[model samples]
Target chain A: MTTRTGPPAPEIRHVTVVGCGLIGTSVALALRAEGVRVTLADHDPRSLSEAVRMGAGLALAAGEPPADVVVIATPPSTVAAVLRDAQARGLGAVYTDVASTKGRILSSAELTGCDMSTYVPGHPMAGREVSGTGAARADLFAGRKWALCPGPATALLAALTVTELAALCGAQVCLLSPYAHDRAVAAVSHAPLVLSAALAARFAYTREGADVLALTGRGLYDVTRVAGSPPELWIDILEHNAEAVADMLEQVVDDLAAVGAALREADGSARWGVVADLLVRGNLGRELIVDAYARRAPAEGVELEAA
Target chain B: MTTRTGPPAPEIRHVTVVGCGLIGTSVALALRAEGVRVTLADHDPRSLSEAVRMGAGLALAAGEPPADVVVIATPPSTVAAVLRDAQARGLGAVYTDVASTKGRILSSAELTGCDMSTYVPGHPMAGREVSGTGAARADLFAGRKWALCPGPATALLAALTVTELAALCGAQVCLLSPYAHDRAVAAVSHAPLVLSAALAARFAYTREGADVLALTGRGLYDVTRVAGSPPELWIDILEHNAEAVADMLEQVVDDLAAVGAALREADGSARWGVVADLLVRGNLGRELIVDAYARRAPAEGVELEAA
Candidate 1:
């Protein structure tokens, strides 16, 4: 029952992905499946060679023509520099970077004198615990949300091309501003990383030993599952969105302290109000997050909610 | 590669379960599968009838002969009272409970003047989002840890009988003391519940609306997954183990505050040390918890680690 109600789809015949990581290779493989020619590049020759071996795409050769779109799939810190270099080389008619944070990257790209009109900053809400080109799969973005945060100067053609690229890779589009994107991820993603780590860190310091660990159930397992992620990668992500994440973390700390105080109060019965309030809110919030996916499942078109 | 070095199994011909909730019914069903006659009881007649309909067991009849073992599967707050009443009625030769917390129930059971030597307190490390007999499964405890926290006065026969019961239900046994079990769960289960709720509560109050909700990925979803649980049930759990849960929550608050400060500091590069330390510990702790299960899989015998 859901339908797309915009202009005709832009033709994306050739695309170049700057980093042959999990996301880049997955994007290349996905587009290749749809008959779009994909060119791959990476600072590490092994990653580029592995992506090519995995049938993702051909390695970008020297003196190549400008492609329809160039995707910067590097880490968050390097996205702006890569975007500037790609634009300077006239790599594509439209440009986008698949970075987790948006505001910092957008501002840095602007500072580096990149053409903002041809750039549509985006992030795909799909990933695995493992990384690199070897772990990439074409179906990684099959049913995930691909967020497109376009600047005011971003040309409509550039936005349309990126949206079509997301669609071709089997993802729905979420439209929001750059600042909104960063804040949203800080609340949902970056903040949870620190929270999960904090919870798991308790397990590490416990003098009670393995028996204490033995008492663990599925709830603890699920809550701290992401705690085992590589620290270097998470540190970088947290650094870019530090302020927003710190704000969310402080909010969590306040709530935790309130609940802790309630639990330690002399009057046992009175503590229920403070404890139950946060829990009820948590239940409601969890439903909101879960329901978003349920509502978006049928409507494959762009969800146009911006800051 | 794993072998049992215990005495020959105890002959448990019949069993009586006092509460016909999810865990209680599952225990009865597991014993029934082992060719033991089972009798089920619940304060709610509807629950008793439903358990009977599901072939968990026959409903408890007036003046029935005492069974080999009695399992109390009531809520955490009501467990001690149920144990006292069951003991007064001469319910069975051996008695045990499946409450999540231990020290409170054991002390209360003693204060209420119940027989101490015959009772073994247990907690199955298994549950589902839904509760009650309707959601009960025969294999709910399969491959899960069933903690048996035997008091100093608890007889060997009583502890052995409960361990055998756990084995019959396809569970591995982890033996610890009452206070230790409470402290362990405070770290793993109870504390994680509050933490998950605190994380999810942010989404409930977000002014950014559905667009921010749409930005949620699997990481946030997994972290806050249990936040949707019923608050009344959780409040009761926290209240019973209030001090232990509060202690762990305070530790979490401290870690979060430190990380938040590090993120907000003026020096950008120096923050990695504090942030990465917690993440690395979190990684190690997660491995410890995961490895506990992996290590237990090959050995079905009791894991004898106590405080």
Candidate 2:
């Protein structure tokens, strides 16, 4: 396999993106904008056509490509299968998968006897409320953190090539073990989805909640926005990262119990103290997240309306 | 007390606003912009001076206001006490409040033996993340719902006068029982505060969460935006509405348990079905909120950025 080096080199030529969904289409658009030859492929013929129309790439039939890099941006449950199929078909010199849960992808790839060295398990920490090729943007990954889980066969040249790809898309690249990546995303992303779904379900069962819906404000909108995500996508995510998500859910249960006990005792002081502690900690957590994004790419004057 | 009908007879009359904080300052600005005399009052000397500089009529001492309408914009914990104190001093001909939790406000006013007829338990469903008079904006309440919890002494003249006040400030008037208002807000507003706080605390307790913080995206940011709200304010809200909040919390716990169990069993089919049910419900809940807000005042061109 040919290797590329340095900044803005002619090393990167043709790129093949296998899924043609939101993330895959987005990656293809970003690459095409950088003047790379992009090939779009998908089991769904409609998605492939949509990706092409969205400027992701030209529709390509299944076969080996004379491309430098291949991106597998399918759902978590299908990531391993797509990776194996692409590798067996000799799709590209270097390949990567943009599945949220990385550990499962790597494990499944191993079970399928796919080459690990030539493959990188990656997760782009960026997305929108909407899905499909329609939501794909060339700058979607700009200034966001992209986690690259490089296994043993991940040559330094190949890893650097992926990093360059991320940088070209204006994203910051971070390295982590596949296990660590999956666990971290489960805690921050997957667990929040589950928690939000639970909250919405709770409101649905309450008589007062009907009235609450009438009085809804930005507070509720912010907290439950993730609850509106596609349910099937979340099911795939939760099933892949079940252990980590369950652990977080149990912790949440303990916290809720303590809060309930404090409120039950009618100790205004204790209740306030407990609730205040949790809120302050939440503020700190949020600050940490904001700081991370600011470091990667400053928001650059995105004015937010007052809450 | 002399009550005049038909829009204060076009007189440049003074309007006294108690508390001189975020809501009060905003109200003062809104009223003053309409060429009305606005006298600001606050126990805090600093807030009093700030309100005066912000175009409110001369800062009044702690005495009866020589004005027509008085708006009490103090914190929930202090709403009743302040109203009672103001009424005892014969502050104004008609009075109202902007406290968030209303049932407790009325109950406390009753305990203090204040004339309910003269005081209206009002809450404007609008705010900013930042607090204090400095953060106040004249257009803060524009196109938002301003709920009026009228009492027995809520004469038609006074109600009409306040309704005109709401219209002048670009807000839609909503009248409901204080109890119903409290129940609605607890589910949509107060309950989400506790839920977000709990999620934040749980995230902070995990090592993987530390890593995830650096990879945060818009989803996490939107979900936890309210988690940054001042803890003291939430404590007061939750303490006053503990029973309602407790009930909501219990339902959330039940839902969480069901979701966790389904995922743990690797029951993808069941998990997907359950989450689909929740997503559908959540979509319904969101649509109801959007429609209500749109009906109150069409949000045709409101472009709010991510919080």
Candidate 3:
């Protein structure tokens, strides 16, 4: 391995984004917007060609020199394999990923015996209600959190290069360990996905629920928006992050049980307190989320809590 | 009751809205936009005056002639009492409400022995992340579902007037029995709210979860947005609609249990299938919600399903 263990390069002059899905295409476009030479690659030639037609990037020739950075934005299951191939080919000076789960990807990289010094497992805290390369946008990462989990084996220059990539894409860079990243995403992302799914799934088979689905205001609409993602894609995510997600989901299941008990009560005050407690806690979480989302736009004057 | 019973009116021109909260002020502003004579009232003089200054309406005088309609946009617990008092004082030709629950409010009117012919219980499928009169906007109900649950005692004239009001406010009017309305809202709106809160609450007390909360992407953010609603307000809603909300929550709790069971499995494919099944169902539900939300703007070309 070429030891470029010094300060970060000033800029990522040439980059290659593998797997031309939503995240890959978006990253390529973002990097391209910053006047970087971006190259697109995917197993599906048509997919990569379409991304190129959209001006995302040109296809990297087989004989092209190693890029300054390589972003593997493929499915979680294939991340380690793709990274190994890229490393075998000496594809870039630095390598990173945009998978939702990091623990599994990192472990897979280890098991596959890839060059670890160049790999920094990352996940962008951003997405839309829709997916696919067709839904990609250059500004997808703008002002969103982009977690960078640099392993002990990671070289300082490689970590710095990924940091530069995030900044150029207008993302707030966050440092997290692979294990820590997996657990955090499990609690807030993975488990919440299942929670939203289960709730929305209830309406799918229940006619009474469907009859009034239209009557639901923005509240239900917002709560279930993420449930629209392609099922097979989520299956891939959950399969890799199952254990951590299940742990977080187990706790939420307990909370639901408590809510059920409270709702069954005929006593108004008892039921009111249970609902209020959970809701108050939820208000705290929501505040944390909304504030973190805007970075600089903190909300104010929110004083309504349970009496 | 006055002998005013016939087909739906062409339009409702004169209206007064009580409560001076988010829903009340929004209704007043929407009515004003439709060239209707709108009056505002509330127990809090400062609130009503603030709404007036925002041009929501002029405050209704103690001795002014009754408007064509009086909209009671109050908390669920007090809707019946306010409606009864308004009916006793001959406040308007018809009365309606914008409470979230229907069964309890209807029961309260029965308990108070109010004149019910001029009353139509309505629940607008509209809200925002923020609330109160300060956050009121005239387009709050635009293109949203507005359910009108008229009892047998409801006069045709009264129902027609309310329909006109909903139409003028750019809402699509729906009809249901008060009992049916309560159950429907409980299934689609109320239960989903608790589901969001329960999922969010898990993250609240979990220190590990908090560390990663900022790292989460849009999936968690959308699922928990509704959990930010004022706790006291939600407590009132949950109390009034506890039975129905609880029933729906019971089903969701069971679904969560299923997910947890499937997640505990060691086999990746087995767990993957379960996640896929639930996520597929979720996709169906999400489509239903999205289609119903935008009247003429149905999404298309979404074909990715579980493998």
Candidate 4:
């Protein structure tokens, strides 16, 4: 991780995490280790109890004092409702939600006529195939990009509080527009998921083609790993932000077609060049990603939005 | 690794590995560790000297005695020349070539009028994106599939010597026909490579697309990792086994087109189902691969064919 050069900030005193899923539980665990008083809440009693049992945080009891911040650790679909509830009850001085999609959550909050100034829409770009409180870890956010989107007229205190929370979790806080977040993820995360699903799906359905996948190796396994992601969750993610995903996937489709044509042509010279060009591009793309992720500091990289 | 149940076979006494690249250096190291006397050779004087310095084996002198076995570790295109040279000189008791493609090498051996009875064609399905002797590791072949394909008239001693080499290197000796070997690797290895190259190649060519790759994470990286393989080396492997690779890629092309069409349709219901179906299929294919690689035992799984 890149070293921090700034003066130290005040420690967070109280944090209330709503929804005890993977991200929520992990966030709670991270905060609790920093000596913050963390209160955990979830509508699902079993999940709530699991998070508490795993020492993510203490169970939120009735009539507790206002927390320093309320993190809406729910699915993107439910973030607006949860934020609205937290605002109505004055649950925290500042609020944030770690949803995968940013624009949708912000739009939902705007529709509900909630206090947008106190809310920061967030997305921690870290996940695993297995999920839920059971799979949560304190180090989940370390070195991962935690994209935060603030609406116009957002209170400075609200943004600072959320940014502080991200720093506490050891995340690289990247300032992104809700639209940019959707686009970036669509290009990197969402499109890969769709592409992997498509490839694996084809391998499964062929009559004479079962043997094709039967010859498995590290290459094939690595290529198809994302296809195993839970479809129940993915269906929600894809349908919610289908437009950007569709756009990115179209580009991928065009690229795939070019290679397909090259392979099909009898004279492979022209098509072979096309194939090689794409491979080189993929190499550059992968290098760009690794460099961006590995080095989050220095002048070449963008720092978290100035406080 | 899964434990072995059989009594230990006779150990290989003297091994001579030609080429001195990653696989060659690694084979020499694995043999040397097992107390077998090993000698190394390469067309390039530097690589040969480096492997010797790294203690992979002693460098072959002008008049060294014939080793019990001579392993041709050259690139696929040069395997035939190396094996023919070795056979003509009576360099060893038997001969083997560890080229990625089998059919071409076997055919080349036959065309050059090499003694098929003393030569066995082999491929160890293990590699890194990096190349040359510098990347070699003693345990490189451990738990990997070392495919050995002998001619119909291969001598018993030659086949046994190659099998012993695989066992000494801690590899699972998988006996395959040259045709089957080519076809299987095409399905699992070559097609995935082409697909990854196509995806990454697309990422490189687009003006705005480069930024998309900069945001990459585990999904894109894993899918595109193998695209960085040295183009010169891949060109030989692909051209030699182009027919099988082309055949496998045809299936991939069909799958990719179906998904592409599904993504293009405005009413995504039919197309969405197409994507989901491929995902489920990919899951099964992955499971089949893992099972095949992991459990190389029992009546259900295929084993090294008895001589």
Best by TM-score: 1
- Candidate 1: lDDT over CA atoms? 0.87
Number of the top-ranking candidate, with lDDT as the measure: 1
User: What interface Cα RMSD is found for model 2?
Assistant: 4.3
A best-first ranking of the candidates according to their DockQ comes to 1, 3, 2, 4
- Give lDDT tens digits, candidate 1, residues B132-227: 888889888888889998988999988888888898898888887778788888988899999999998988966665778777778888899889
Docking class of 2: acceptable
Give the Å shift of residue A213 in candidate 4: 7.3
Q: Give each model a TM-score.
A: 0.96, 0.90, 0.89, 0.87
Better of 2 and 4 by DockQ: 2
Docking class of 3: acceptable
Interface RMSD of 4: 3.3
Residue B259 CA displacement from its true place in model 2, Å = 1.7
Candidate 1 DockQ category? medium
Going through the candidates in the order shown, the clash numbers are 0, 2, 0, 9
Expressed as tens digits, the lDDT of each residue in B1-307 for candidate 4 is 4544454443578889998999999999999999999988887999999999998988887778888899999989898888888888878888898888899888888999888998989988788888988999998877777788888989867777788888788776777788878887877787677767665554664566644444456777777778777776776677677777766666665765665566556854665787666666767765565555454322222246432
lDDT of 2 by residue, A1-307 (tens): 2243344432777889888878999999999999989998888898999888877889876554556888888888988888888877888888888888878778889899888888878788888767887889999988788889887677776776677677666676788887777767876788888777666655554555545565567777778778767766777887788888888787777777667667667554745677677777877776776665466663322211110
Worst 10 residues of 2 chain B by lDDT: B298-307
DockQ per candidate, 2 decimals: 0.77, 0.42, 0.46, 0.39
Candidate 4 - chain A - TM? 0.90
Model 2: DockQ against the native?
Answer: 0.42
